[model samples]
Target: MNSFSELCSLLNQVSSADYKKILLKEYLDSSTDSDILWALYLLSGRKLRRSFDITGLWEILPKLAGLPEWLIDESYQISSDKAETISLILPVDPDEKRITLSEMIKFADDISELPDSAELEKIINILKSINAEDKLLFLKLITGAFRSGINKKDIAAALSEKYSITIISAFHFLSAADPYEDNPDNLLKYYKRNKKIFSSYPFCSAQNQDTASVFQGDCKQWLAEWKWDGLRVQVIYRKGELLIWSKSGELVTEKFPELFRLSQFLDDGTVIEGEIIAFSKGRPLHFSILQKRLSLKTVPVSLTDDFPAALIAFDILEFNGNDIRSMPLTERRKILASVTEKSADQEIMYLSPLLEFKSWKALAEIKNSAAENNCKGIVLKKKDSAYSGNDWLSLNLEPYIFNAVLLYAQRSLNSEMYSEFTFGAWHNDELITFTKTSGGLNEVDLIEISDFIKANTIEKFGPVRTVKPELVFEIHFEGISESKRHKSGITLRNPRIHRWHKDKKPHEAGYLSNLLELLNAGK
Candidate 1:
């Protein structure tokens, strides 16, 4: 428990990824398998099964420490944390020995089985034996509020380095690790096997091909497909078994049993990459409908009948017991068309449509008009590129750039960093606020903007500073829709500052008419 507490303290101090990895590596080397497994389970954001609920803590803590409600509230307001306040006011006994991690969990379970009076007394006595840090940790564990700033991937990376395994294998192993079912030891065995037969390959990402490059290349050498607004999934059927993995590497087979039912149609040793979308009356439904289905742990028969999940198999990674990732995409598509053709459920499973364009001009027109077909955008892939190749580009038509005026800037809590800025557009002589952007600014730009904001401050209100509406910024966004909550009466999806439009004036910025035109045009 002391070593675990020390590790947690060390993790909180370092901000560097390299330093965090070093600390984790050192801790892993010194700890036993049981201790390391417990640490990893906590680090990966998993908590113990609740043996007791601490819902009454607010009432219990004040009485236990003899602190008034007002003092506790004031401390919480200042510290911005409840756990820290409880730990600070609670009485401590330094002479008592610390309990082991396993003992702590066992103690909580044992106390939970007792009556309320005995349980409360046992908890208070246990808290007295541990330090403030461990007390907070133990309480968080029992209450299921444990969290660390460290990324879960870092834990996998550290373990991979320690065991001399590939990062991907380590990631999959970590995903399957669970302490309650004795899964940590099983994960070590799976790591030893290193089998990726049914494991989904890490998704291949596309780079943004500039307009110049798109025009410079011949259309015949490229393949175009609609970028479906749905979840990307990989379906694997092997050894009379089925598996579905989301792009994030989550096993989602159990969530959609309707798609899992299609496994019988596919042959063994087949793996295909595709999109999971909701369909109704032979048309793809809105992505929001698919999201509703995803949120359900088990899809109801009635909802399944209504939404009817479907998959558009876009690419084939494996076919008939052989890995075909090295094959050219054109060849793979041919194989994919043939394999999916063997399936009986054509309505639930089919190949994605391949757009035919003669020239870049024609493709651009298709891309601009994609919204009419409810398409998000278009993907361009080199015909000769392998299925595993990274030579693919995604271009969206809705997210067109527009010039906007910077209306306000907000300062960061800790530093003088100008973290967020409110942007607005001219709405018939009024500078109405629409969206706030906090990212996509370089350090130099931030400093320049910060200095300009300080020199031109007009008014101050809390963290927000109203500056002279003289700064114009070129904002890039995804789409515009009517929004009553915004002062401009419209919402800009994912607005980000592209660059400082120093050459433009506030009066010359965008207007409500222009935004309405965009909304009407459905661009």
Candidate 2:
């Protein structure tokens, strides 16, 4: 546990990707197989079920530390992390023994089996026996909030370097096999033996079209398709079973039962990649409609009838139990068209139609009119390029931008130092909060904004501070709609900060009337 805590601290401090990979490799080399497996699992953004109530901890920690609850609450407001707050306030013991990561995990598992009184006693004893750093990690683990700077890509790269395997293979291994159940000593062997039907390949991503060099060449070398505004998924059928895997590697076969018709149509050992759009009356609906189905574990008949789902099959990755990723996209598209035509479920699965364009100018004009067809934009794929890397490029429509004044600042849940800002627009001479966004700010900008927020705070409401509405910012979003739930009577989709308007006055920001006008115009 001490070593694992140190590793997390070191990972948090480093900025260089290569150095982080080195640290990860070193940790893997030094730790036991069980410890390494759990560490990788946690670092890869997986967590055990949180067994204890966090609110209960907030109440109990004050009693154990002999400190006022208000002090702990205030410290939590500053840190924005419960683990850090409790670790800092609790009294530390000088004579504490080191614990292993597995032991700590086992303690967490044992919490559910013990009685409430026994659990509280165990927690108090463990807290008293561990150092502050270990205590922080243990608290985070039991609460299922153990997050670090490390990502799956970094871990895959470290494994690739250590095992002399390809990064893609390592990624597939990491995504497919459960580290808790699989033997770390036989990681490669198990990855090779695992059924391919249960695993999803690394999704092929797209670069922004403006930055890609493919456009500089002949337009004839590329194929254009409408970039659907829906969820990207990989449909897999193997061993007489069908599965739908999201881009994030979640098994979502049950989420869209309407797509289960593919099992009768698609051949065994075939994998098709496409977008799952909410279709109604033969047209794709907005992503907001499709999002309703994403969280449903059991889809009701009424919901399916209202927002029916369809797959716009665009590419074929595997055919007849063979990996065809290395094949040219032009060849794969031919195979894809043939496969989809034979499926017979044309309403549920349709081939994404290719856009015909003679020149880049014509293509640009078509891209500008993407929203008219309810598409995000256009995607360009090199006809001769393989399906492995980022041979595709996406040209998305420009986001709607609005200038608004910052109204409130609260500590961000994702980080300890940064704060999420709420911005408001003038509505009938009153500042009304419209949206809150935490993205699109660098570390330097975050620090500057944090300092500004501290100096301009007018009132405190627990973790949130009402700030003087003086600073203005440009906010960017995809769409807007009317809503009765908000005081502003409007909602913006996927809003994020675009830039801080240092020279603009609060009065110069946009008004609620303008947003309503834009929303009505869209309708």
Candidate 3:
């Protein structure tokens, strides 16, 4: 292994993107070509193939550090980071040998192929030559868990600054091919070869606006579309290949095979942004249902029958291999309508309908019907605004009842008083708090719920008892707003328990996105 402890130290010291970029660029300028390639893969969020698993790491750590297994286990429980736990338990090396990034990756690959009898001695020898900090990085790389604060965009920024190219171009270059095998010189060559092709573009987000302020705007210059509850995605079809990118730039094509098959109908070199919704009998289902359909390589026949997938395209970024982001939204919408009607299957792909309104008063009445129509709110986009930089606004119709899971319960300060239940929704696997209320349940209901909570308690933090997420309750809130204090990033206003939804599962609980839509609309 070549000396590469400096890189780990740099990563530990900086948190800002700018500083991280500077350090990366500096290292790339001085490091070997192989080291630069490995750095590019790690900084750009590429997961390298793991040669070993952490299951053996526990057994290996004790022998390497001459420490008891219990000591390492206790440290891991406190830190909750496997890399950090191993690093903390290992002895520090004063005369550590410097290992290059490529050499380290190669060594990990070599270790994975070693027999179980020989692997422990080999791992210990490698650890003995490196300090704790570099050992953590090495272990992380071997385990394919090398996530730092930096992301692909940060690496792109550094590349763009160093090479004097656009950040978007850098993104395209990095995404076009594997960095481990693709040389830096290929960035320009790849860019020139596919300069006309459209890559994923950053989503133009909306600013929150009050209900009255949004309606008072010029109705003639604004275009209204229903804000469907689904995953926002960008679908690009270039040179007979289709790709689906989520809002966060994640490649989610394999997750929705049905959507990928439908995207095959799009014209080559076309890019459209839309929502991937789960629909049944031609009506969109809740976001919870859509969540179940995600992260899947193939949908089962039984599940697909219950929740079919569909795409609702609303905006066009490119047409016929030409960039049209600079075009006025109204004109682009016309072209989009024409193309969708010509090439897309009406049953699978939908062009979002535009609503015509004479005034704010007229629109207000229509928005009130959102709940009945399965619409969360209405998106107001300026007709004359360009697609890339235009500031869109969302107007939420009303706050609807949402199903949340019971997270933790706490009794009121007065012992004779009622118990307050902390309610939260599931964000992926995490249960995040949105509201706490004690007003909805009666004396009998409180006693029943309190007894259930006590029986299912997992842990206690002061006065609060953290219970298992087995109970589902329907909650109603007047409005939603951004709150830094909450884990969900938003809080509900005037939240109260509507009723207990005993039939619902924890995974079916409402998401933070449920409140974010209304909070985003009102902002």
Total backbone collisions for each predicted model? 0, 0, 8
Candidate with better lDDT, 2 vs 3: 2
Cα-based RMSD of the predictions, in order? 5.2, 7.4, 10.8
In candidate 3, what are the lDDT values of residues 345-367, reduced to their tens digit? 54667899887789898888777
Winner on TM-score (1 vs 3):
1
Best-matching candidate per lDDT: 2
Worst window of 10 by summed lDDT in candidate 2: 190-199
TM match of model 2 to true structure? 0.64
User: Sort by lDDT, best first: what order?
Assistant: 2, 1, 3
Deviation in angstroms for 174 in model 1?
3.6
**Order of all candidates by TM-score, from best down to worst?**
1, 2, 3
**Could you estimate the TM-score for every candidate?**
0.76, 0.64, 0.63
Using TM-score, give the best candidate's number: 1
As for lDDT, the candidate ahead, 1 or 2, is 2
Question: Which regions in candidate 2 have their CA more than 4 angstroms from the true location?
Answer: 10-23, 54-94, 145-180, 192-225, 231-265, 268-271, 280-283, 288-309, 321-334, 341-348, 353-372, 377-509, 520-523
lDDT for predicted candidate 2 compared with the true structure: 0.81
TM-score of 3: 0.63
Residue 104 lDDT in model 2? 82
Q: Would you give me the overall lDDT of model 3?
A: 0.75
